[model samples]
Target: MIKVESLTKTYGGFTAVDNVSFVAQPGRVTGFLGPNGAGKSTSMRIMVGLTKADRGTVTVGGHDYLDIPNPGRHVGVLLDASAQHAGRTGREVLALSASTMGLPSSRVDEMLDLVSLTESESKRRVKNYSLGMRQRLGIANALMGDPQVLILDEPANGLDPAGIRWMRGLLKGYAERGGTVLLSSHLLHEVQMIADELVMIGRGQIVAQGTPADLLRESGTFFRAVESTQLVEALAAAGIEASPVADGYRTDAEAIEVGKVAAAHQITLIELKLADGGLEDLFLELTAETQRESYQTGGAA
Candidate 1:
């Protein structure tokens, strides 16, 4: 399991992470979600000891990551797929990682196969590899030691649809076997499909954390009326604010209440349903408030 308690980090006067806390348990895939500049990467860096926390702590299993013996064998990490040396071949990269972890050279071949890198591709220098191939190589390197936990940041960034599907299956299988997984990504739909739990951050602080079902339940209703302008005016008159959406308007009002308002306004209903765009809608709602605050404060996104 991974435990992060009151984790904080800052750069100059800007707080990159703020008193954040979350847990990634074994046998579950935890999705770490946030908008750009929301400290997802900063928190992950602190978790792996790549960055120092101003306060609080992050631990893998029961010990600090740096304190763990043969850390690679205990915690597999792939923060940046592009961080690998361009001078090395895919095979060479895995071999180097294996050597550093005191694993046999045969482990390199296994990883290459596991990540489905062809022999030709593995033999070519990383500089010549496509982003997808590089991502595969990075994943291979992370799993080279068969670690008990995995922390991947935007692992699907460069993947194709098929590659993304494969990665989802791979991570699911890993978690099924009792390995802890915490991955951060902008792919909300993908995260919704695979993550057992979600931790959403905005402006360096956790705004929400729960299972997909729980988050969905927190989402408001979405309704559209035949006469959009009249409906908006009617809802406002009823002391309810509604925002215009692509299809129509969105409000926190339940379907029953919206129906009453539409009926009173002599407006016909076009569409009325819960606005559950799954994780996407929830993520946007959670971050939109912070985004507005950032604009007002002239803070970096």
Candidate 2:
């Protein structure tokens, strides 16, 4: 288990993390979500003893990371995938880590196979590797020690669709085998599909933390009908206002409620289902003030 309590960090007058606290439990994949510069990376850096926190405590399992006998053996971290030595082969990189961790050279081969990095690909220099391949090598290196906890920052950044799917399965399987995972990313939709629990942060503070269902449980229902004008009129008559969304109308009312209204008016209901856009809507709503948008390709925020 990974626990963070009242963590705070600042650089000069700028606060990067503020009184933040959350747990990434064993047997679960926890998503650390936020917009860019919302303190996710800073917090993770502090967690792994990379950056000093102004205050509060973070521990993997039970002891401080620095105090652990061999921190990498207990907490696998992949904060920057491109941080590898450009001159070394992928296999050479993993071999170095395995050697430092006192593991046999066979362990390096194990990791390469685990990450599906073919023998020929593993022999190529890191500088020649694509971002996706580098990411794979990074993951293999992180798992080189067979750590109990994993802290990753945007591991899916450069992955293709299939690679993303493979990574999702790998992390989920790791958690299922009783490892703790705390992954940070701003990719909202991707995180929703993989995380068992979510911790959302903005402006250096946590905004929400809970299971997807707990935070997004109230996602409104969607309604559609063949009798366009008549359906809107019927719902309005019943005092259940629905506004246009997608190819249909969405409302706070339950599907049953909307269905009953349509049935009562003899309107041909076409579609009635749960609105699947709740996570995105909630993410936007919570981070509206913290988000920065660039209007044009070269424009500044």
Candidate 3:
């Protein structure tokens, strides 16, 4: 498990992280989210001892990250995929990490395969790999020791749809196996799909933290039809009140009822799901007052 308490960080006159606190439990994926420069990166850096916190405490597995022997064996981190040495081969990077953690050479090969990097690709220099391939290599390196806890920042940034899907499944399986995953990403929808808990930060402060269902104030079914007008008519005919939200309609009716209504009307639904108010809606609502149109005032937290 990862726990952070009263964490604060500052740069010169600006406060980067303001007494931020959150916990990532084992056997669950915790999604860390924020706008650019909201101190999401800074907090993660502190957790891994990459940056010193001005005040407060952070611990991984009941001990400070720096105090852990062979920390990589217990906690994996991928803060910046592009930070790997350009001169080294993908295989060499994992090999070096494995060596540092006293892992066998076979572990390198296992990770490379797990991330779907072929022998040829692993042999290529890191400078030559595409962003997606670099992400894969970075993941391979992080998992080189089969760490029990993972702290990843934007791990899906460069992945294609299929690659993202692959990663979602991999992380889900890892959590199901009782590992802890603290994932930070701008992909809110994907995070909503996989994360068991969420932490939202704004202006260096935690704006909200909870499961998606807890944060979403609206309880209903959301559905969008190809012919929205006619679907609204059909729903009204069925004595259901619906309100427009995003590109869809939200109704107090359950998903099955909405589906049945659409089916009876032959309305083609483009999307249908329970309205746990979606992550996008929750993010925008909670952080709207705190969001900066540009990061100029927020600094490079």
Candidate 4:
């Protein structure tokens, strides 16, 4: 539902986003992930036409965001919850958003209830609302138009664990109902749990994009184990190589096949385990080297 092509953005000499491209498909939640200063927010801004890209284009359902008639009716964005008016009550703010979008005032009330803020402290100014409450109000505002696409940057920030889980379920429900969701967050575990696909950026470039499982599978770690003392011989016979692990062997062979080979050779199974590399492990490994390289370059300078 959302497509970005070679989107590039620069400020003076600093490139904030560089030739990044990715797609957010309908009926799926796509996680936009990157480290701090990795251009996630910048890219999001460009996608929504809040910030113009130096090069490339972003389209929502084949129309440029700026050119889309009633863009808010098609894309619900919560890039910054704090961007709301501090003096207005949450209901007032949502009502205003609804009015601006030519949507019914009833939608504002529905969204407030949806976000569980229907009985919020009556007549309280937004400045008095807790961060989490404000965040919920922001979500309500985003939902006022019943947009088909949601672009939420750190929607889980400041939310309690329960609230975070609620948010996850909400997004999942939205996607299940055919809405597209693009979520940007620093919480890898949350993203790992919720995202159907991942778009990972590093230093303003897309380092990886795929299903979380696919990315993890590609970068996954493998373990090789053997039960008998003739471990090296068994591996050689099977045309496999093994490396010494802590009190065992670590090989990039399938555990079931390895076990079958061991059993065939009468190798007693002492210890055997497969270490599947997960999303967090793979994400760290992929981004850590880039951080180290940047640190080294900075030190040299």
Candidate 5:
């Protein structure tokens, strides 16, 4: 398991990560989620020892990342796919990583096959490869040692729909076989499809963390009515403030409660259902406030 305890980081006076703590457990896929500048990358970098934490600790298995000998055999990490050498071929890059991790050359070809990279494509220089190809090569490099733990930051950024589906199944299978996976991405729908748990961060602090179902259960109910103005006024009068949507309203009250309110107000209901896209809604709600504050102050977040 990957354990992070009160992780913190700062650049000059700006605190990038603030007392962040969480765990990516074995045999589970944990989705690390947040908006841009929410400190997900900083935390991941600290986890792999690429950046030093001003305070707190992060450990893989039972030891610190820097303390592990030949760490590649225990953990696979892909923070930036474009960070590879431009002069080297895709196969060459994997070959070099395999050599550094003390793996035989055969593992290089095995990973290439696993990622479905053709021999011709693998022979091309990194600079000539497309972004999707680069992502595949980076994934292959990470898996070259067949590490038990995976930490990927936006691995599907450049992937096509088919590639994204392939990656989802691959990681799901990997976790099923008892490997731990921590994935961070902006694609909410894709993450919702595969992630077993979610950790939401905003302004460098965790705002929510739970199973998908748990988080959704905590979200507001979506309601629509023929009398939109009356429904809004009724809900507001009952101490339930609902935000208007394109064709509906969202409130934190339960469906039964909404029904009771509508009945009391004599409002004609068109639709009432538990909201899907709960992750997206929750993320926007949490980060939008901070973003607004940043905009008002004329300072970047």
Candidate 6:
């Protein structure tokens, strides 16, 4: 539902985003992941037309954001939680957004309840809201138009554990209902659980992009541990090499197959652990290399 093509953004001599391209499809949460200073925010800004791109294009539902009729109604963006006026109440802020879009004022109350901010507090001003409350209010404003495409950056930043879980479920549900969600976050674990696919960026470029399972499978091998004092010998007998792991030997064999092999020899099966690389491991491995290169270059200079 959303496509970014060769999106480039430069600030004078420095390039913040460089030829970055990706697609966010409906019925799945597509994660936009990168470390700090990797141009995630810059790319997001360009996509929503908040910041003009130096080159390339972005489209939501086949129309550029600026060219779309009622752009706010076509795309809901929550890039900054503190963008609202501090003097306005939560309800008033959302009411203003609705009015700007020519939407009904009832959308304001609906969104407030949707974000679970229906309860009025003594400190009702935007300035007085907690960070988490402000984040929710931002989300409420984004939902005011009930747009098909949702673009959020670090939506769970100030949320507590329960709030984070709630946000995850909400996004997942939205995707399941055929809405397109493009979310950017540094929280790998949460993304792993929430996103169906990921676009991983490093140094303003895409390092990898694929389904979480696909990326994990392609990045490394899964090993199953078979505990035996004769592990090395058994592996050698089976024409397989094994590596020592925390609990037992790790062999590049299917877990069940390895178990069968262990059982055949009566090797006294103890523990069978599967060692598969995760998103965190892959992200660190990929980005660490970039960081190392940058460090080396800086040192030379």
* Candidate number with greatest TM-score: 5
Q: List model 6 lDDT by residue over 186-261, tens digit each.
A: 8899999999999999888889999998877665333433445575577568876665543345566656766666
For model 3, where is the 10-residue window of minimal lDDT? 292-301
Estimated TM-score for each candidate: 0.90, 0.86, 0.81, 0.83, 0.94, 0.82
Deviation of model 3 at 84, angstroms: 0.2
Candidate 3 residue-wise lDDT, 166-263, digit = tens = 99999999999999999999899999999999999998999999887776644568788998889888889999988776667778788888889889
Quantify how close model 4 is to the true structure by its C-alpha RMSD in Å: 5.1
Candidate 4 local Cα displacement, residue 27, angstroms: 0.7
Kindly report which residue pairs in candidate 6 clash with one another.
none
69-130 in candidate 4: lDDT tens per residue? 88788889999888889999888888788888998878876887798885555257899988
- Residue 127 CA displacement from its true place in model 5, Å: 0.5
Model 6's TM-score against the true structure: 0.82
- Which candidate model has the greater lDDT, 4 or 5? 5
Q: Decide which is better by lDDT, 5 or 6.
A: 5
- Pairwise TM-score winner, candidates 4 and 5: 5
* Pairs in steric clash, model 1: none
lDDT tens digits by residue: candidate 1, 182-284: 9999999999999999999999999999998888766767777779789888889998888755466668788788889899879999898877757876787
TM match of model 1 to true structure: 0.90
Worst 10 residues of 6 by lDDT: 292-301
lDDT of each: 0.90, 0.88, 0.89, 0.81, 0.88, 0.81
Candidate closest to the true structure, highest lDDT: 1
Show pairs that collide, candidate 2. none
| All-Cα superposition RMSD per candidate | 3.7, 4.2, 6.7, 5.1, 3.6, 5.4
Q: Residue 142: error of model 5 in Å? A: 1.0
Q: CA lDDT of 169 in candidate 1?
A: 99
Candidate 1 segments exceeding 4 Å error: 233-240, 260-266, 289-301
How high is the lDDT of residue 25 in model 2?
93
Clashing pairs in 3: none
